[model samples]
Target: MTFSWRRRRSGRGGDGKSEVFKGINQDMELTIPTHFRCPISLDLMKDPVTLSTGITYDRESIEKWIDAGNITCPVTNQVLRNFDQIPNHSIRKMIQDWCVENKSCGVERIPTPRIPITPYEVTDIRSRIVAAARVGDARKCQELVGKIKDLAKESERNRRCIVGNGIGSALADSFESFARFSVDAHVNLLKEILAAFTWTFPLDEEGISKLKSAVSLRCMVWFLKSENDLSSRQNAICVLKELISADQACVDGLMGIQDIEETLFHTVKVPICPKATKASLVIIYNMIKSSKEKSGEIALKFIRMGLIHLILEILVDGDKSVCEKALGVMDSICSLEEGRENAYENALTVPLLVKKILRVSDTATEFSISSLCKLCLGENESALVEAMQLGAFQKLLVVLQIGSGERTKEKVTELLKLMNLCRDKVDCVDASMGFKYIKRSN
Candidate 1:
């Protein structure tokens, strides 16, 4: 009997039943086993291609599945392709079954797993995110959130890997995708990625150096831009705080931006909310604190730009917390040689600071007074004498006497001593204010 297996036709036989046949016309025809049929092609598989599209069987057909991970066959609706390129022994078995069942000319089909999408895939995500954002599809926009999270986790792992390998430069290229996507997306994920990058600090000299470069670039963009959503702003500020430690270059890079100074002054004066005002003040304080040691040049630049007067304005407006922070910043600025030189050149910062102290109500006078005395007595004997002449002595003594804290009293006494040292320049009325208070108490 000839086992014809080349062509089959659907028909009803004489028995009145439907018939199925593999082939009908030729002798010695090879019948392809069910397993030999490509799950996707449902034919003898040829030129099998493993593509990243979640399709693994035909090079031509699977190319479309490359990015589509684990796609079902369009014809058979079977899970015919694995796009991730992750190795699975079970998938090997499926390919093996096809090889065993086919009985034509011997053809070896090697399954070449697809190459993974490079980290550059983040750009694709960024484009999609922008499109989703444009259409106001919060759901689609939110979907990118998961991808961003995955990217972030992948970036962190890569960073640790690079650090462990002592290939810090590797991390720089690794995170380029995350950084590029972050800026393109212009969302909170940028912050998350930045935070992850920063978490790898002190990894190695090279890694730390690369981190500084990355942070400087990111912060420069954030600080220089005038337009960003509140969440973006918050994220940028949070990252700034993280990268602030022991990175003078990064701190100066942030401070060197004109927009940061403008944003700060504008926001403090015309805040969108009290919370925003407070947050901005806190960021400023943190920036100052970060640059406290190596900030002399930048501090002087800001002073020359009249930042002191702006801060003084905030203090005089009764923003007690903000005022206190501004005062602390002033103390930091004046303590530095460059800052003092700038203050002397402007010839306004000391007087403004002293005036702020004198104007502060008695209830909140202690911190302001201490901050002023620290700024004035340190370098400007002349400014301290001017402060005493402005009735600052009376304010300081009153704070010393009635203030609940011993530190306040000690700070007041120290200011009096500094003032006494400059008694020749101080007016007698102002000079005697402290003694008169002391006599009354006696």
Candidate 2:
């Protein structure tokens, strides 16, 4: 049903009728004006802002759309030349006036939205955080961190403005500077700093270097083991992933901390959250991808810690995204000769790696194929035989038919040739052989 209100105007040139609205209100039977509604939400625009494409939307809706990585105008689909949000003051005023006039119909006026924080304000906040950290003022530092976290949550604009002003580097610098303070007395301060740092992710090179410092690494490991709050631990792991990726030297720093590997292993074995588990996998991958000598040492450490078994189990149980990350860690470890030998010895390795081919994402497929190739190319004939019996040949053929990158295609072709060369041995192998468990050599 259409609801409208028409008021007569008494004037010389008046047409004697006023404009009408097309709106719907099932309970109150009230009609709203079409022009007063936001295109994206189909509700009255509370804080209308127009885009460069001449389309107007509610501030919250449009900001969320843009923040989600969209660059086009929601209505027109035109590419946004800039990210500027121009407030539609006249439309907001009209909406307020309409709400007041329709007060009897239960329409309430929306309060004016506060202006977004400016870059200069974020710079000042950064200075305060730095100053607090410099003086070893734990109380002051925690308060400033809390305030920054609250400001970040206020709006996307605030976050962008703060990030643009380099709050990430400031937080990392402050966090590193906290090494002089006592850990027991400043747990809350460190935790709050980590919590706030998560809001400023994708840190720059300078920030990553500071966060990966020896002191920072030790403190983060402590948080992972001691913090009762799951979010705090997850944030610590997330930050660790960045710090580890900063450089190969980062792995050397982690090796000195004996419990860090164990902590990460337990996290993967008994996950508190999918995100934490995936981050742990990436961290392991980076450690395994370290410089030649350190890479072997780190890979051996994790393998002895039973990370390989956990990775195989995750391949069977995890969702596609988690499986992809697990495969990445597997691929990196298998790059080492010792790693390949360990994988070749495990019964679950062949079956699980074969199971992942073409089943998950393309990246997962690449990792699975690369790791299998490494293991099969080894001196172990049984590894190749296991691959053939476990349907690796068929899955690999399917991968080829579907098209792959040049490098993947090369590995696929090479593995297929090797398998075909041993077709006689493969046929004699028992088809019912569920798994071939080759015990690790002493």
TM-scores of the models, in the order given: 0.44, 0.80
Question: In angstroms, how far off is 426's CA in candidate 2?
Answer: 3.2
Candidate 2, which segments miss by more than 4 Å at Cα?
1-30, 38-43, 49-97, 100-111, 246-249, 291-295, 428-442
Candidate 2 residues 55-142, lDDT tens each?
A: 8998878988998999999889999999888899898899889888976655566777667887888889889988888888878878
Q: What C-alpha lDDT do the candidate models reach, one value each?
A: 0.52, 0.79
Q: Count the backbone clashes (under 3 Å) in each candidate.
A: 8, 0
Which sections of candidate 1 miss by over 4 Å? 1-141, 144-177, 180-182, 185-224, 228-231, 238-274, 289-292, 341-367, 403-411, 421-442
Instruction: Find the 10 residues in a row with the least total lDDT in model 2.
Output: 432-441
Model 1 worst lDDT run, 10 consecutive residues: 16-25
Query: Looking at candidate 1, what is the lDDT of residue 57?
Result: 58
